[model samples]
Target: MSRTLVIGDIHGGLKALEQVLERAHVTTNDKLIFLGDFVDGWNDTPFVIDFLIDLDKTHNCVFIQGNHEEMLLRWLSEGHDNEEWRLHGGQSTVDVYGKIDADRVSAHINFLIKLNDYHLDDQNRLFVHAGFTNQKGVEYEYFKGMFCWDRTLWEAALSMDATLGRKDLFYPQRLALYEEIFIGHTPVTRIGYSVPVNRANVWNVDTGAAFKGRLTIMDVDTKEFWQSRPLPELYPDEKGRN
Candidate 1:
């Protein structure tokens, strides 16, 4: 049977990304849902995009727009950035692009431009780089940026009162909107977990490849996970986002 895999933030750790896919025994029959931030951090930012674009030709791939992708696009296409972007692994991407030809740079820009803000599968599971705020669901979301920047949804999930039932008036409405929500951006490593963290119906899959953790991919239905060696080991010479 085909599997639907939800991947965590890559942060340009292409070696780690490749290893986990191999360990997971990923097949072309499987559907890959990337949680974004494919660029920045490591040194292979451009190569990772190239592999992803090529992978899409043979397998079903869903790409969610990450905040890093958005930041990279603005810098590449218009030389615009939020200033803080450089401090958070953005310069690594800039370093790679500085040597890449214009044609490839343009292609990478187009790739970012085409990424989805959020993807809701037939099972009503939402996949986004970050959480949405509107209690009604992503359809009712007013600020699209929240799809790649919001942390409150995951925070709420993490802090959910175990005694709180869905029917309770005080229960978070955001958690009730989807059967399950898969998100990246906020690394679970912040709380000392290096694996996928589940709280309520939301799963935070970012294992902090940008820092000292590993890159991960999870079978959404089975909840079985595969991870690369800790990224620091994969690229010992680099500090990544640390």
Candidate 2:
């Protein structure tokens, strides 16, 4: 049977990405949903983007726009500069793009430009890079950026009272909008988890590959996951957003 797999933030660790795919035994039969931040952190930003673009040629893949992708787009298309972005791993991407030819740069821009803000599957499963804020759900969110930048959704999920039922007056309405939500911006490692985390109905897949954590891919339906080795070990010489 075909499986739908949700992957977390890459942060440019191509080795980790490759290892996870191998470990997961991914095939063309499986649908891969990537939770953005394709660039940044490790030195393989451009390479990761290229790999994903190529992977799409043979597999069903959904690439969500991450805040880092947004920042990289701004830098590539408008010459916009965010020092904060640089400090957090943007410089590595910039350095890689500097030596790349114009055609590939254009292709990377095209790839980043066409990323999805969020994807809601037929199962009512939501896959987003970050989180949405509006209680009414993603459609009612006033700012499109919130789809790729908001943390409130995750925070609210984290803060929930386990005994609260959906019908309770104090239950969060955002959690009621979907069968499940998969997000990737905030790392679960921040909360001391080195693996995927489930809070309320929201699943955080970002195992903090950008920091001192592993990259993960999970079967959305089964919740069975596979992870790469700690990124620091995979890229021994570089400091991955540490």
Candidate 3:
């Protein structure tokens, strides 16, 4: 099979995303695994969604639902007006698609609702928007908190050497389950982080493109990566949260 490339948070930084793909020289045979956050915090949410949908139609693309995407689906299901939605970039989404007819909106919401929580490729790579489950009485399969806000699993996965003061954080150590995990949802200062805990695997590829940081992509098998520097701020010009 061809190699798979995993991409991290877009956050509406379509320009950066496109540039990263160009730099990576992504080909038709290569698979793209997107770690969600497809929209929000930037001006091109509609364009990004449309581009992603088209890409999926033409290529082999696997996308996991990020917390921001989950929020969008929730808002659509329960009426799109709430304090939380307004605070978390939903207003911009509404502004983009609110003028569209009801049928299109319903279709978009339905498309998002069907997204899977995680996707495991044949090559033994786990692709998810965030890290694995929570430790406090939450099953890994049911750990919604980890996907959106939990940092424990993310840190543990990246803590390569115990001497670095990270082992204590992941006490009762859980052996890694996959050969590699390609994840997003936490934008690191760098384009990617790797922990050789079990093998030469485990990677976090979120570079916070929407926050005037880099956008990144990594090949799952070869570990080849590419990044695009952020452009100057445009529109609304406010800081965003993870």
Candidate 4:
């Protein structure tokens, strides 16, 4: 069986990432799929990015982009004063880099810009950062809403009762291309195992590590899951999330 270790949003939690990887027992042969939002929330973006870059050199790894990463890229490229981004743990990421030098900041933005929007494996599995979509072909923007939005699609998919049939409401393109789609954006109260939504299989590993929640990792082949609580200081207030 193909072993894929899918991890939830890291949010710059380097300790959590290390702990979860150890708990999940990720090996060299296994594919490590990070569900994005690797920066922000925690004050360790520099360390997290450095570690992930090093990790990529050693193993097969896929890093999907998330909305926060998108915003970061936009601000860095356009010289936008993003106080809103800063409010939502973006400042923490900035803190890690220590007042972004032009060259170093460009390097970081380049890394974020290069992240894949989605990953579709031949094993009927789809991996994305923020959300999932039924859109296909020309409709799929390589760096558009498919990567960072689509929570509405998720909720509609989950509200279904059956586990095998497709839910029409969830399909933006009215096509069921994936038998199982794993995503990280909406943090479920539970962690580890797959959470089924109608015929749409959602494995949200985000565990809200940046908001007083756990860090989650799941083995896609075996459906095994692992979790660990986040540091209290990393917790965000309700308003902070806005």
The stretch of ten residues in a row with the least summed lDDT in candidate 2 is 162-171
| Deviation (Å) of 123 in candidate 3 | 2.7
Whole-model lDDT for model 3 versus the true structure?
Answer: 0.68
Evaluate model 4: give its lDDT.
Answer: 0.70
For every candidate, C-alpha RMSD to the true structure in Å: 0.9, 0.8, 4.5, 4.0
TM-score, model 3 to reference: 0.80
TM-score of each: 0.98, 0.98, 0.80, 0.82
- lDDT string, candidate 4, 19-106, tens digits: 8888877888899898888878777777787788889889899989888888777867876658888988887666656665778777
lDDT of 2 by residue, 1-242 (tens): 89999999999999999999999999999999999898999999989989999999999999999999999999999999999999999988888888889899899999999999999999888999899888898888889999888999999999999888777887898888898999999999999999999988999999999999999999998999999999999999999895
- Sliding window of 10 residues with minimal summed lDDT for model 3: 191-200
Better of 1 and 3 by TM-score: 1
- For model 1, how does the per-residue alpha-carbon lDDT over 104-220 read when each residue is reduced to its tens digit? 989988998999999999999999998888889899999999999999998999888877777788789888878899999999999999999988788999999999999999999
Error of 4 at 207 (Å): 1.1
Error of model 1, residue 129, in angstroms: 0.9
C-alpha lDDT of residue 2 in model 3: 70
Candidate 3, residue 188: lDDT: 77
- Write down the worst ten-residue block by lDDT for model 4: 190-199
lDDT pick, better of 1 and 2:
2
Give the poorly placed runs of model 2, Cα more than 4 Å off. Answer: none
Cα error, residue 233 of model 3, in Å, equals 5.6
Provide the clashing-pair count of each candidate structure: 0, 0, 0, 0
